[model samples]
Target: MNESTRQSSEPETKRQGLSGNALGAIFMLLSGLGFTVYIVLSKTLTEDVHPVFLAFWRSFIACLISVPVIMRAGIGKLKTRHPGLLLLRSLFGTLGFTLAIVAISADFDLTFSQFNAISFSRSLFVTVLAAIVLRETVGIHRWGAVGVGFLGVLIMVVPGVFIFWAASGGDGFSLDLGTMTAIASAFFLAFAIVLVKSLSAELSAVALLTYANVLSSVLLLPFAIYYWSTPDLETWGWIIVMAGVGFVAQYCYISAVSVGDASFISPLDYLRLPMATVADLIIVGMLPGMNVWIGAAIIIVSAAYITFRDRNKKAQKVKVLTDR
Candidate 1:
């Protein structure tokens, strides 16, 4: 085998009866579980608590949890040269986070799996946003992938609505409002992803996260405090758990990528759909519609293809440079 082929295979080598890919898959699965659980916890609280307040407290608790870790990086890491990009990313991240909670709120009346399915579209959104914001070259293949992926999103979101909307007298369209909001949440998050790419050149991940938490808390403090009510003991327990687990989920994702190639580990994240489905079934006796499964599968495949292709393209570029 060539050096490149051997290099690629190294991550797959087993040690202690487990390979890096296996460990990465495990971590990604755990991260997905943590994230899904956090969403479920937030959904539970949204009935009794306002979404805005929930969003703010999530940031607040995350801020508290991150204190020691950020402190270890010292106050200096908190300072960044790219203040404008940082601020923009933070705002976008906060809005995305808040919108996600609102989508899962009682106002939406969506099933747990349905709400989580919206996130499948995020990678599609990121592709479009990258082209627009980053001026990246997107080949026709990727464009086709994006188009097909969004068809899947529509399938999951509106399903029969498009076919029957005129016959249903528009009621079907209105009923899809919740799903649309979830897609919008994904849009904002994809925008944040593009911004993070730009800022990563100058910022540590910890610094970026700290800024997001602090800024989100500050920006959201007024609204949260305005709607705040004293939570009962049980609610407090959920709040702490949600915050702590959510933060850990972020670390789990980071560590997963650090341990294995992004292409190998990213596919494992699709496990979240089944994980969320099972969670919904057990916790709320809810099951995702067939449309959601079909759509999610399409989105997952398209997103994985995009990631894999991008990794190969980057590797080829490196190979070309090395040959020179």
Candidate 2:
């Protein structure tokens, strides 16, 4: 190819890449908003329905939502050589999703924003888990970021502990089950992320999701059935809405990652924090406490730093390799 031709083509290629990234950012934003609704709807429903039953419906509805995708991909696409790891992923993913519902079911007196803030702790957990479980070499910057992130978590959590104590007239400091379950949700989610990193090479994303929904539905079925109460049509509508939004959010997230670099798309997920706060104010008439704002800022900054730094490092490595 002539030099002038190649130079002209480069700009076009760059424009296409930029356009793709923009599309991805939009998808990720919609995903964040969808997830925000999912949280609010789930919280609203906790009044009459058991979380276990809610989780079961979530899985079942998600599976129903996936039917078209699964059919389009065909049965062959669902086959995976890594069944054990997929099972492990299903186990942790199920725990993470169900525990999140369980956490919200508890009367923590927290707004949806405050409750959802704990979910961001998953990134910190993923960093540590990558080092321990995957034996991935994490640099000093990442480690430092993880430390600061945990400090932010403490900032959010310790204040709540104090508030609870004062409210209970000095009933000695103890973290409530709701809070612990939220943290556990983050932990399980992190583990599932690590497992995904391992299994991504051997399995298609569709296959992984297909198994996750199907297996979680089966796992939660007994508990869901035991606690089942027939929801009125209105409540059923809300449940379907919750599950539909969640499915859309999941689809958008996957589409975003497929189109753009994960690092580039990840910062968009933080939009859920503010979205949740807005949903809280509008739906529940609640404002987040100062601790949530302060700690969430710290966590978001630390996570963004980690993502950007890692992206730069990867870019430099690619450049060096290309030059050679």
Candidate 3:
């Protein structure tokens, strides 16, 4: 094998047994679980909590918790110090989060699996957005992969409505404002994630996180007031859990992204379904039938292909820059 072949083969070889890999995997899985629980909890309220209120409170908690850590790191280390970009990130990320909550409130609402599918679409969006924003070349094979991913979304959604209609016997297609909002949330979030990832290169993860939360909390204070409802003790408890878990999940998730090649990691991203499917079955007594399973399979496969292509493209670009 050539040097490049040998280099690629070695990472595969090192994973032959359990090393420290278990710890990272465990943390990642925990992170996933935490985020999933947050989604499930959010969906439990009967509009008892407004979307804006959820955003403000959750972000407020995150910012409050993050402040001490940021201080300990000193003012300079809090972030990369790009004010313009940080400002923009905060604005866009807040908008994304706000819109996402609105969408969730409007749609099928959240389950563990559904949250994963929607949040993970961010990765897919990054690929397509990068092509446009950066003017990067997109190969046909890459476009084909994007098409396949969308096909999977269609599969999951179309039959979903039909299944609802059938379940009702003579009702109608389950097209509602909430469902459409959920779909739109998925689309916009994908774009938001791409923007965040781009800015990530120039910012500290904590900084990126802190600004988004703090600024969002500040910006949302006025709007969140109108929708504020008296959350019961149970609701408050869930909010606390959601805030804490969300912080931990993002922290560890960023760590995972740092250590592993997204190409390799992205494929394992498919494992979200199995994890969430199991969670949903246990928590909500809902197991996906054959249709959801098939659709998920297509999405997983396409996502893997897209990640592989993106990594290869990125590597080539880095190589050219280094050679220059």
| lDDT winner | 2
TM-score, cand. 3: 0.81
Error of 2 at 95 (Å): 0.4
lDDT of 1 by residue, 1-324 (tens): 999999877765643466678778888988999999988888888888898998998899999877678899798877778888888998899888899988887777777777777787888999999999999999998998999898888877774733443454334333366777788899998999899999888777887788888899998999998998788889888888988888889878877877888999988888888888898899878787666787788888899889998999999999999999
Worst 10 residues of 1 by lDDT: 165-174
Candidate 2, residues 30-136: lDDT per residue as tens digits?
89989888877887788878988999999999998786788898888876778888888899999999999888774555567866788998988998999999998
What overall lDDT goes with each candidate model?
0.84, 0.84, 0.67
Q: What are the runs in model 1 whose C-alpha is more than 4 Å off?
A: 1-19, 159-175
In model 3, the number of clashes is: 2
lDDT of 3 by residue, 174-196 (tens): 43555455556656656656667
Model 1 lDDT, residue 122, Cα: 86
Q: Scored by Cα lDDT, where does model 3 land?
A: 0.67
